[model samples]
Target: DQQVKQNSPSLSVQEGRISILNCDYTNSMFDYFLWYKKYPAEGPTFLISISSIKDKNEDGRFTVFLNKSAKHLSLHIVPSQPGDSAVYFCAARPVGADGLTFGKGTHLIIQP
Candidate 1:
């Protein structure tokens, strides 16, 4: 069964606006969340991460929020730029698991 899911297949945001990407999980064992951004031909690079113990985490223009009760998480990018256009994957790791489960990913298009 798919543990992680990004309900929206794609999202479009105007430049300099806030872009919100959402994700949900069915596994209660998940204890960590990671957001990765991938370009057309490049490997997915880490964007930001948050632990289940916390509700939010931020890094520069990127922020990740986790809601254990709802089994949902989201990534927010403020002041979206042209270079922010890419595919974003939501990944989660279960307690004590060394590997991570990834969602299908959402294509974020930054319109300028």
Candidate 2:
């Protein structure tokens, strides 16, 4: 099954603290992973991605780590800000697929 799971439906963090979001997958064929941030009405925007060949990837304040053996991944946001409050979705695609399978979503709330 092409299922990506985000166990937590939401998270809250104080500004300037660290925010951590988790994801898990059951599909062994997924070789590429991505994290997207979304606002209420707009579509998700790509945040960070990691290939199966790599263990981690980072971009500015965002970082993603993948554990292929465990079929798990996480995204970390350092010095979280109110602007960072949004829905985060973890997605995965097999090597040849054109689309991604996304988790339901995790709403990140950054309290001022």
Candidate 3:
């Protein structure tokens, strides 16, 4: 079974608005969570991440929140731009594991 899941297959938002992406995981041992963005025919690039010890993490125009108790996580993108349009993937890693478990991905489209 997949450890990480992105329930939404795609989302559309107007430029300069906010885009919210959600993810859920089945493992409690996952201590690190990451969000990666990928363009078609390319590899995923690491966006932002949060440790289990942190409930929230923020970067310029991006933020990630974790709810350990609920076994869920979410990503927020502010002032969405057309350049931000891509497939976003949610990934999780064990406390000291070398590999990551990834969700299918959610396609985000920024409308003009």
Candidate 4:
């Protein structure tokens, strides 16, 4: 079963604008949320992570918000730049699970 879902296949944002990527999960046992950015011909790089117990976590230009009640999460990128364009994947790990479930990923295009 697809426990995690990234509803938008792609998102476009103007340079210097804010881009929001959304994700939803059906597994209530998930206790961790992670966002990864992937570029062509390269492996995904960890962007940020948040625990299910927390509502928000930030690291520089990246921020992740979790809503346990809603079983949803989002990644917000401010002042999007051309270099920020990539496929973003949302992943979640269950409370006692070692593996993570991932979404299909949403391609973010930062337009000039």
User: Judged by lDDT against the true structure, how good is candidate 4?
Assistant: 0.95
Model 2 TM-score?
Answer: 0.96
Residue pairs of candidate 2 with colliding backbone atoms? none
Residue-wise C-alpha lDDT for candidate 4, range 8-109, written one tens digit per residue: 999999999999999999999999999999999999999999997799999998989999989999999997989999999999999889998999999999
How many clashing pairs does model 1 include? 0
| lDDT by residue (tens digit), candidate 1, 6-108 | 9999999999999999999999999999999999999999999999999999999999999999999999999899999999999999999999899999999
Alpha carbon deviation, residue 96, candidate 2 (Å): 1.5
Each candidate's TM vs. the true structure? 0.98, 0.96, 0.98, 0.98
Mind sharing the TM-score for model 4? 0.98
What TM-score, to 2 decimals, does candidate 3 have?
A: 0.98
lDDT of 3 at 8: 97
Candidate 3 per-residue lDDT over residues 1-112, each given as its tens digit: 9899999999999999999999999999999999999999999999999999999999999999999999999999998999999999999999879999999999999999
In model 4, the Cα lDDT at residue 21 comes to 98
> Runs in model 2 with CA error above 4 Å?
none
Error of 1 at 70 (Å): 0.5
Model 2, 29-52: lDDT tens digits are 899999999999998999999999
How does candidate 2 score on lDDT?
0.95
lDDT top scorer: 3
